[model samples]
Target: MSFTSARPEDLLIDAARRGDVPYLQQLLADGTVDVNVQNGKGFTALIVAAYDDQVEATKALLAAGADPNVQDVSGNSALMGVSFKGYPEVARLLIQHGADLNQQNGNGGTALMFATLFGRHNIVPILLEAGADTTIRDVRGLSARDLAVQQGNEEALKLLPQE
Candidate 1:
């Protein structure tokens, strides 16, 4: 069956979470399912795919014109979700697709900060090279560097700007 706006957003989101690229493409083929369509939790297919590290699915959603910067109820974007989860491949895809590197959540936490706090060393440099602002502080006044220090993330600390 062809998709319509009436199609359940969760179906598409679930497909993304599951890394079901074929089903996702099928749903998007009709161009009816908005790639940015959010479920009750405010997760779009792109967000789900990125958070779950479904590189192919993420690519499909972006190709389908998903808004990479769209944030969830907590103001977490696809980039931030991937960062927090330590999905470097997904982070790279999101970055290459023009996701905002400095977009913060409701707590003012940037992707870099999450990567730092979570000890996602692999993603820290990727985000920095992509121009994520290390100066931006969270609501608690912690920058990515500070978070790195607080979390004792030596790997991230070494890669972070000394400023």
Candidate 2:
């Protein structure tokens, strides 16, 4: 059987993924789309926008009341996605919208861990300043500082607090 077409709410996610700010705005204005709707993977529009580096879209979603702390199936939040992708502006927006800095993913990885793992030096300090707990260990037993050391990210290591 042929699957049905996309729903209007799904369009919000699509628009956010494509960075189509105008379309996303229109969808929000219609008031039919739930800003916090999750896709098959459990990702909200804000997470998709942040993952795609759509700064404007990310901002619009936050302004429309998207939950910055919403996680996907893997427990990865919008902040983690932006942090991993090195989207500092999007990361900032997520944080400002009340994202839990210490929220851990399925692997127990926080935004700080993602930022450090990907060598996102610019984002590292931002997370640190936001009070991201460096002591939190991932499922692999690696803290953000540990990951920085493992990745040979000297700058990140320098920024991390010594154990």
Candidate 3:
């Protein structure tokens, strides 16, 4: 897929950020815009949808074969972003489509760690069910459960799998 530049893909991404599902769908169906195209920062359609909290857009991108595990320049995947933002449905969809459950982000934080740190108790069980590594230690050797306990997030602590 050749292009004059990333202009067209940028427009498609903007539409996705605004939750313009129809326009995004049209652009995707037209096949002119690269479904997996990343912007200057390496954020794909799925990443944009997850960032903007557009559940339908995320689902569409995934169904269109967007690689859920693709990372941006900063190594942030859609699952990590969704988990951080506490978007359960979107996270579920991404996981259903094979998003890496144990993928660590640029900061060496997994989706489980992000969910726990952000107090997204609802997202923990989902991540665990999707096989997120409970024993993953970040650069500081802090697991998700450890972070939750350190932050005094009792809710997240209850949701995390015990060692």
Candidate 4:
């Protein structure tokens, strides 16, 4: 069935969340789903795909001009979502497409911080490679290294390049 604009845009978002590539492609090709539409949770199709670790689906959205850097209502970008979820492949794709790693969320937590705090060791390198500043502090003035220490994640702590 053809997707309708009244479908809340989140249906396509949900499809992405499920990694339903074919359905998502169908929706994208239908010419009705807003590529940049945000759901009630402030998640866009790209964000959902990244969080789902749907690398192919995320690439498809990015190729179709989805804004990888589009922040949710809380200022969390797709990169942050993926990083927090520990999806290195998805995070890499977002970064390769120009996702800003240093962008902070409503809580002033950068993607690097989220990755470190969540023990996403792999994502730490991806964010750093994307030009994420290790020195950037969160609202509490805690850098990624500090958060890693607090979380007792030695692996994540090792990702921080010494200043």
Candidate lDDT (C-alpha), each: 0.88, 0.91, 0.87, 0.86
- Point out the worst 10-residue segment of candidate 3 by lDDT: 2-11
Residue-by-residue lDDT tens digits, candidate 3, 14-82: 877887888888888888888889988999978998888998888778878889999999888999998
Q: Of models 3 and 4, which has the larger lDDT? A: 3
Model 4 gets an lDDT of: 0.86
RMSD of each: 3.6, 1.9, 3.9, 3.2
For 35-147, candidate 1 gives per-residue lDDT tens digits of 78998778899988999889999988899899999999999999998888999888888898899998889999999998999998888989989888889999998899998
Ranking by TM-score: 2, 1, 3, 4
Residue pairs whose backbone atoms clash in candidate 4: none
> Taking the tens digit of each residue's C-alpha lDDT, what string does model 4 give over 1-163?
9754548487688787788778888888898888888978788999988987888889888988899889899899998988888998888888888898788898889999998999888888878877899999988989899998899989987778765
Q: After superposition, how far is residue 127 of candidate 1 from its true place, in Å?
A: 0.5
Query: TM-score for every candidate vs. truth?
Result: 0.92, 0.94, 0.91, 0.90
Candidate 4 differs from the real structure by a C-alpha RMSD in angstroms, to one decimal, of 3.2
Error of 4 at 157 (Å): 2.5
Query: Per-residue lDDT tens digits of candidate 2, residues 1-163?
Result: 8564479878898899999999999998998889999989998888899999999998888988999999999999999988888988888888888999999999999999999999999899999998899999998888999998899999998999998
What lDDT is reached at residue 90 by model 4? 86
